[model samples]
Target: MSVPAHPRVTDVIETPVAAPARPRHRADIEGLRAVAAVLIAVYHIWFGTVSGGVDVFLLLTGFLITGSLVRAMERDGRIAFGAFWTKLVKRLFPAGAVVLGAVLVMTYLFFPRSQWMTVIDDVRAAVLYYGNWHLAAGSVDYMADNSAASAAQHFWSLAVQGQFYLLWPVLITLAGLVAVRLGVRVRRVAFAAVGIVFVVSLAYSLWITAVEPVWAYFDTGARLWELALGGMLALVVHRVDLPGTLRMIAGWLGLAGLVSCGLVIGDSLPYPGFASLWPTVAALLVILAGAGEAANGRFSANRLLGVRPLTWLGGHAYTLFLWHWPVLIVYLELTERVRPSLTGGLMVLASSFAAALFTTRVIEGSVNRVTKRHRAPSWSLAAGVIFIVPVLAAGSLWAHSIDQDRRLRLELSSNPLAYPGAAVHLNPELAAGLPDLPIHPDTTTVARETIDQTRSCNAVVEDTEVVSCEFGDPGSDYTIAMVGSSHVRHWFQAMRTLADQHGWRLVTMTKNACQFSSEEQVYRGEVYTECTAWNADVMLELAELTPDAVFTLASLTDRKEDEHVPTGFVDRWRLLDGMGVDVIAIRDTPRFDFPVPECIDRNGRDECSSPKAESMAEVPPFKDLPNVPHNTRFLDLTDSLCEDGVCHGVIGNQLVYYDTDHLSYAFSRSLAVVMEPQLLEAVGQAVPKGEPTLVDAAMTLHESAHS
Candidate 1:
């Protein structure tokens, strides 16, 4: 109720403000969907980057599904949950199943053997509608960008959409249940719940994107608000109407903004972050502008959007989205192309479009026809179950079989004669036939073998302080603190062997990407704030342990990109020297940008070697450290790993760098024969001499993995 307008305005009685008018038959929404689907597929192909189109789809899905379900419940007094869900499954699954099945066949025929297990694992996740989480766990991992890109990676959005389809209805049902119990309207209850989620999830997305972008990019929690924002618009638009002038402005602005969002945000942002509002808001305006027929005749965006071609694409959008990614991947792999040349990308796009058209028409239409013959909701529901169970089971069985196969390969690698490590360096004959074909350890294991080190001993990411894992003669009086990033940790196999022979206690206190230094280091694409703090904590702990000597790589390390000393190494050396802790600083090894196993598998040994000078950092030797005690010594071991200044991916029969930079455990262990003497000289300086190391030089441990 409004107070009577002030008497100053004259004595006209005021009336209640009416709600905006609602319109039906939004052909423009369909057109917007077509635009979004094309942008998403096109951007993914040509630019090889996200184009903010997925965010638009997420919102559109949220709004359409929520609005439809809410309207049905309101009109019929209760939802036909079984019928509703079955209809949705029928519309979506057949197309998705077609794509998955095709990809599986393609994987066997085309993808590298090393990628088989990873893609199969993703297949299971995709079928179960948790592909996003699976990807979040792997792709957003520490040093995650290093993993080989997967064809199924694009399934993450589809999975998010599928999960939302199941979850949102249940949420609405529960909201209705609560509303009845409290004697309030269901719409009010549902809206309140949705509004609450929007606030919480948006806040979480903002915070998580800022802190852990890898996780944020694929996290369901971080992306939920995008869908919810769409749902909210569905509710608002259903009850409100805008005048002609307003709709006209929104129509033109929304269309232009929708097409240009990718340009504004670019590829640098950790999105669906706060910047996501740009696309979602633009989509909302499009929906608003499309509410009813235009008052301005040809001026409205809806006129163009409602045209024939766009609406047609919108009808087949789901199939197109499903088909494009795998098609793109297969085309690239078969052509052995990277980031697709224009002609190749065009071929991929055309193939995807053709596949989409076929699946949507034949498989999708046929399934709908069969399901429609039965009007009973229960029959359709059972049919949906029958259709889904077998598909999911097939994925699970394939994943298990590949997992068992991988374990067998790893077990076989353990045999002394079977998998040589660095001995390949000593015997070039070992890598003779490997370079001519595709050979690799499980591509899935690359991250574990590289950054995470996969050993149960490494500290978790949450461990901000030093957490030590002991190895080799824990009771020994002489203690050696093995420290550095994953690069340093890769030497554990050799270090463990050396410590055993000398009766020395070995403690590993390293973190992912953490280097022992006083200078700031980068982590996850930003300044590595956590690494700097962790390094400080580690230095404090080493001071307390007062170990005989700290074994760590001392020189600046460079990979495919830049080279630099961890600016704080000098400060750290001075502090350690003052504490009487002598340092055994080893010159850092060369880093290869590409995976050695993958390279060696495809190319000859000669072709797989990286230039030594280009890969190595040019830091000064420890003679530059003015505070060095007489006991402190520096060692350069580059010659042992390189020949003629070119580093082989496989030296002897053993693979060198696992993925790109990190040495495999096997290769590092093979170096025990070489490392034993050098370490003996360094540790022998302080501790009473012990028995010599007994490593077999002929059977060098060669089992290594790469970055």
Candidate 2:
């Protein structure tokens, strides 16, 4: 193939040199795909780390697709965007649809009903090729119902690739158009556009990964730079004809770096940031080395990578990637284990490979043959519609059923006689026949009952700005501020009942996974800088408002099977006492390593309670702390929440803690009976203004759910 010539250089009059042409076929690149797939599976299953294999795949997609688009644009004046997209849909959709269908069945069989709605949303997101954004949004939103990792979660990377395919060609076509008008080489313009993307996306990736690594992990913008690096390489790879010896050395060095990236970085650094350059640049080196034949074939990285087994694995790599995660997740769910044993992990790997081989040959092969016979875009479009519509329809129906079930459960809670909640602990009559009744806020729907499920009031994982929600009497003269993390916010239902009856305004200053403390806190092994800033803003807000009473948690279990009041909590209370604001410090609830509701649902509630001695100290730690604020009054309702030595999953037929830690809103409302008198005594208000009953509270909860 004759290469495109650069326009004449005015600085010196010389004949235009022809640019090197990219090869049409590279067996070594196919082998590289096999390596990436293996790394991804191994890291996910055995190491619990990101292998940087996804980054390598992103780079390869950028390189190969850009090369294909540039060639097409050079041959024809413009890219056939419709034909290109249709072909992509035909090639990718069939395998994706098959995997989704299999995942849906696996979820129904092995996963609980409560998790169905989340996985269904994942399915829809995958179908629309927006799974990355969907997962990113949910990952950061602490109160989101979709917190549990779904079987289809791995679709996020494929979704990123699909989005790249949709956008990259258009960018190159536009660059080519501008190049024609400007009378410059198209490759120069294309390279410039890709270079800009590389710099901008890399900067954004570094910023977001540092501040909100969880979201950055699945963010398309954070990952675009990896792809752009590959695009840049494709544009110039042919122009650099390196010496064979240099190519051999670069090849080996790049492969070694690529292999070591996961082991060295392994779950330590926030990803897709500058750290990602290790794997992506290594991939670039490999491609640069293999762009031409080596002087010594035996030692060339390309020669080793191009072995028949690797190339074969590369042929099935796409399906292999899709099959692995769902298989691992289903295996874990069935075994009731967090992670698989070594032998089990090997079994998972073998099963994934087998499934991938079968899927690639049967589903993908059939689609490929049909598309080959009928090359028209319409045929491809029809193929895509055939594969996608059923999954969407099934997901929609499943989501609707979940909503209906939740509404039914809420209605059941409206009757206190059936769902007495914490009241039964005090009233023996309410406890009668409770063992035979159905649990309200059904275990399946309990996880979704977070404060943010109904309203977006608290700051999310990455946000530093203060977001407050006002409940109870907004116009009341007396104010009761609920301040802290979700722990403090979880008690809002009980506080709301008190606020309404006593004519006191209720305000919440809360952030997800952040407590109201002055000391630095660590979350997920990183300094929660956003939480620190949020705590500062909250303190300033409290000083300005200086409410009559400031409500917050007095102690924490610290997830270490022990409870205590940290020195930071005492400092904040003292500051509040200085402001003449009375502090209503409530004891924090028990922290669990596993989801309580899920445990209760899987095994009967009788088998699910944790021993009180295992979760809390014999006495409240805050009561013994030195330098305790004189104005701060403590409330211990642990007896009302846990029975005799055990923290029960269900109290009075109402599920207590929703997930592992936060109390269910329905159960929290029921605790008003125990909470009201303590709150009144602490604030020096008349005891129990209107004496609100649990029945009234239940009705209020039903109304709130509708609202």
Candidate 3:
């Protein structure tokens, strides 16, 4: 061969072929972002369903960010944590800060003063990138104000994404190092690591989603598998070279599945659990179909996704995501409608698009330009500092002011003359001489007055255990058990007062939105499993404790055209009678379509009052029950709760209710004077005829307030 006229260099030397460079940008992914943002906004506006767009966004984030992180770890053997975080903050925070500032301003202008604190808290949570956890906690909280969605509620997804960005790089770096030590391929190890997270998180998600769906909806741990699924795909995308026909089929199927997911699942099912797989898997299929040579297929989704409109929408997707929720919520508030009208929805969509365009071009463009000019990580860090300081400072200041106001209101409410509460109801003479004092437990603090903060023994919505608390003469031989939903809980102030005076040990077994009943109950259209289980456990506990009497609500009121003793209540009463337990059943209080305190704030007390007939029947509804337990005693406080055929929001210079149906603690405390005698008689305690009455005893407090 050497003798063949000195071999040519090209024939003798074989040059090594270089691997194809990874794509710097993906238009198809951007188009998918557009689809997700639009779906979220539209579904929230009109569908009243969880559109799975949030889940899609989560998966996309993992796909978009994980590959780069893994590659960087493999290339450098370590991640530039500071530089990466700085760049991420620079990219995400500026627009977020602007949105927070806007939300604060809008809350002050458009929302009720009572709602300001919630918005402030949400803003703080969003700023700290813990909004998802905050929302998760609030979802399970009995006292959380959720009359309306907070403007920054959508930031929960952003907060999750922000958290993922912080942790994923470190995880990839760790995996890369571990791979080197184990003599394994980086991609293989990374995929396995992601698989472990996916399995564990998915299992947890399924369990929590079934057990406590409301809480699970916003829990980050329950949502991690969605992101890990994308990470797994990212690790192996280079190898996913599907047949052209298969890819084309996947592309169309994914697009269809993404569009129809919310319609199929709706809000009826617990979400971001196994249900979320529909959208997330669809997103993956689309991503896979567009990978490598598959994207070149004639009927590929790549052609449709690369169209100018979708790409343009994707460019503004982040800002659109930021702007749409606030716009929709504010619109709903302004319109005073729970959901937007057809025309209103269109207007909201247009306004959101316009605002997003402006924000992207002005706010985001300016921040991006500055960050680009200063390529150093330190400049990005400085920009981050600038972005965060104002939000923290402003939120802290606003919260401080509200706290001060709350403290002052709480202090003022302690003076009986300033807040006569139910004293006017106890003695009509006091009502005649009532001064025009400011409402007790001011509108902003009213919702918090349902019960004392120190007393947190009631089982939450998710808990099934028989959580009981003892108050007033816990060491007494005499025992009385208070049981029911929040209806019975709101009467705690009065019950505790009577228990202490009468030397009875008062025990409370209560759950929010759950009455003491054996009948199968439905809450928010799902089986009230916790309530049913709690009721069963409570019944067993009651058998062991053998309380002298069980105090609970006697009737149900819709605050509309209905007020009746439910058959379930009668059944429970009969069961207690069979157990040799006496039952003291108070008639249910009036419910309202609006918060009494908020109504009183917007419209004076008299104007906010409704006809007593709206909530009460001509006769006590329990009296008409077909089967009556001999040991059951019925008591009606309708006279004290309402007067002159009207149920007032504020009576005796006191807000009657903390919320729509829950009585204020101050009002409930004042009712102790009237409730004492009836409660004593029901428990077989002697009610002296000649001695100073409870009404007379309560007058002393009013007299002291005057002095």
Clashes of each: 20, 0, 0
lDDT of 3: 0.81
Tens-digit lDDT track of model 2 for 1-707: 99877733221211122333547577889889999999999887877677888899999999988888876666555677888898888888988998998888898887876577678888999989999899887773311222246888888888999999989977987787777767776678889999999999999999998777778888899999988999999988877667988889888888999999989887667776878999998888888888754422688997888889999999999999999989988888887766688998999999999999999999888887887899889999888879888988887887777778878878887777678788776555446555476777877667666554434777876778789878777788899889888888888888887777677898888888898898999887678899999988898898888799999999997556579888888899888888999898999888766788778767877777887777788899977688787989999999987777778888887888878888998889889877776777888876455765544565565445346
RMSD of each: 8.5, 5.7, 7.3
Worst 10 residues of 1 by lDDT: 8-17
**What's the TM-score of each model vs. the native?**
0.87, 0.92, 0.92
Off by over 4 Å in 1: 1-23, 139-147, 292-297, 375-418, 423-456, 459-463, 559-567, 604-606, 617-631, 685-692, 696-707
Preferred candidate (TM-score higher): 1 or 3: 3
Tens digits of per-residue lDDT for model 3 on 563-605? 9877788899989999999999999998777867666756677
The C-alpha stretches of model 3 lying farther than 4 A from their native spots are 1-20, 140-147, 294-299, 449-455, 559-561, 624-627, 687-693, 700-707
Q: Model 1's lDDT to the true fold?
A: 0.72
Clashing pairs in 2: none
Which 10 consecutive residues of model 3 have the lowest summed lDDT?
A: 10-19
lDDT of 2: 0.81
